[model samples]
Target: MRYRPVAFGLAVAALAAVSLTTPAQAKPAASSTTMANTTSAGTTATRVVTAAIPFGQNGDIPVARNYSGDSRYEIAVFRPSNGTWYIRGVGAYKFGQNGDIPVPADFTGDGRAELALFRPSNGYWYVRGVGQFTWGQAGDVPVPANYIGDSRAEAAVFRPSTGKWWIRGTAAIAWGRSGDIPVPADYLGDSHADLGVFRPATAQWWVRGAATIAWGVNGDIPVPANWVGTAKADLAIFRPSTGAWNLRGTSPVTWGTNGDRPQPGNYAGDTGTDQVVWRPSNGTWYLRYRVPITPPPPPPPNCDPSYPTVCIPPPPPDLNCGDITYRNFKVIGTDPHHFDSDHDGIGCES
Candidate 1:
């Protein structure tokens, strides 16, 4: 599995609590389009409401939605117990059912994400208006993406058993091997998602048509994103051991803990992406905006109280070979103002 989207997959199986709760009565479809093994998440409403979400009992994948088209990705969570999706700024919905893997994406290229699901039990995909279709079998990881650059996300899955990727109506290629996690993203700025996989065994990533790089170790979850908005994806990983997110070439951050799931996206509506973690313990979310650090303002230019007339700034600047680099400090032995009889504060005179 993977992170960031078009739509990425993470192995829920590795976690201790991966099983979903019992099935509930799914909402019926608006139209009888003949969906044999399909079900509706819930009805989409125009009314924007934020219902208070209760504590979650089961762990699920992190979801984000750009429902307002405001360029900022709102926080979304899929509660498996009730199949309800609580999205910030948008309303709460029931777009998925138990045992359904959440795959939120921009299916229409309308700049907003749609609620979608992939049921491994029946090997079917339920895209709200796109109809239910059979694409993957049980045990296949769902990796939906816009492989054709047609502004529409195609239903796809990576079969670990055979190391094959099957994109419905698109090409089917065998790229990764068993124990490799599928990482699909728009790597070349082509506006089309490319096939990639992260091998946990070797800590290496092999992207089709792209470069191969070894980055993280086992137990580290992939959290690649468009960090610079270069249209290409950045190779990143969240280390559970250190609670740090390592963006390739950038400084590692200590924003997440052990059980928190990292969800990187443009939550701040800025060019740089933000790091978000979904704490499944209580259904709480935390977003860390990747912003430039503003250096602390220069300290007050406090002159020596004894020599109040000359202010050379406190704590001083870089000290070179000559002295403390204070222009106002006059060498007491060589110059006037021998107020500093002892070698204190400023090395020199006044």
Candidate 2:
């Protein structure tokens, strides 16, 4: 059975307006907008671009296209400390003309999600924290997932040309008979995102995880959410024709109008996914959840206080005459000591 969580209080408002800057001025900086504490039921929402990046520290940053009619885009980061969102950075983009939106994921395994955009000019995918790499294939749909059980998420794409899904995470490729909609989710609660696709023709969602099956129908714009409170991501769809959201185990929600984009996230920090819609008509964001809550940042990684680097055995000492066991504890650098059995400079003679 599909799991559905209890619906929290719903609040909706328009976010604060952000000033636009040129690409040269788009460095990461503190926001200049004034912050105010929002009430439980009423909070001003900020207008943002269609793409959002989860800050990993419990808040999300929204990106917006240049309102000045330039090719540059502005990114507004939500400051949990002040309960306000502000413009954080700006950059020129090629996606605006190509109709591609930026893809956000934790590609560096740092818990903080980064932004990535596909460059139609070079046929390469450019990731924010990571560098640009060749994807070769052409597709607009991008699925950010951790298909290899690693903490780092990889960018996956669905190529409608071949009706196949190519995952850059494990370099694993799979084929599906139909569907070009990209759905990256942790359908098994495994802490790793899996590959999924939605066939709008049949309104069926197919997941490649513990529970792989065809479910739902006539679903467009697949939105993954923990609506059932299972701690596992489930599928939700926005029917543009009716502006209704059909979430599993819950009644249909008449929320957005046509041309609105659905962005599902844990905006409330309740561990259950909530709904946020971006209406292009007014460039305003509409949220359907309780008062926004920012989760505490995760504890720092375990590192040697002095070195400030991950602790590991130092390199082994170079030796020619004794059993390797004797040099087990000896380290020359950060690696365990190595023995030169052949009297050559190279360690381990290999």
Best by lDDT: 1
Candidates in order have lDDT scores of 0.68, 0.51
Cand. 1 Cα-lDDT: 0.68
Candidate 1 residue lDDT tens string, 1-350:
21222222322211233233322323322222221211143322221111222323446556776767888987667777666666654556655577999888878788777778888887867665445667788999998888999987878999999999998886789999999999998877888898999999999989999889999999899978787566678999999888899989877877768888777888767665777777777665666553333356998766544444454333335333254444444332322234345656444444
TM-score winner: 1
Which ranges in model 1 have alpha carbons more than 4 Å from their true place? 1-60, 291-350
Model 2 C-alpha lDDT versus the unseen true structure: 0.51
Clashes of each: 7, 21
Model 2 Cα shift for residue 168 (angstroms):
2.3
RMSD of 2: 20.9
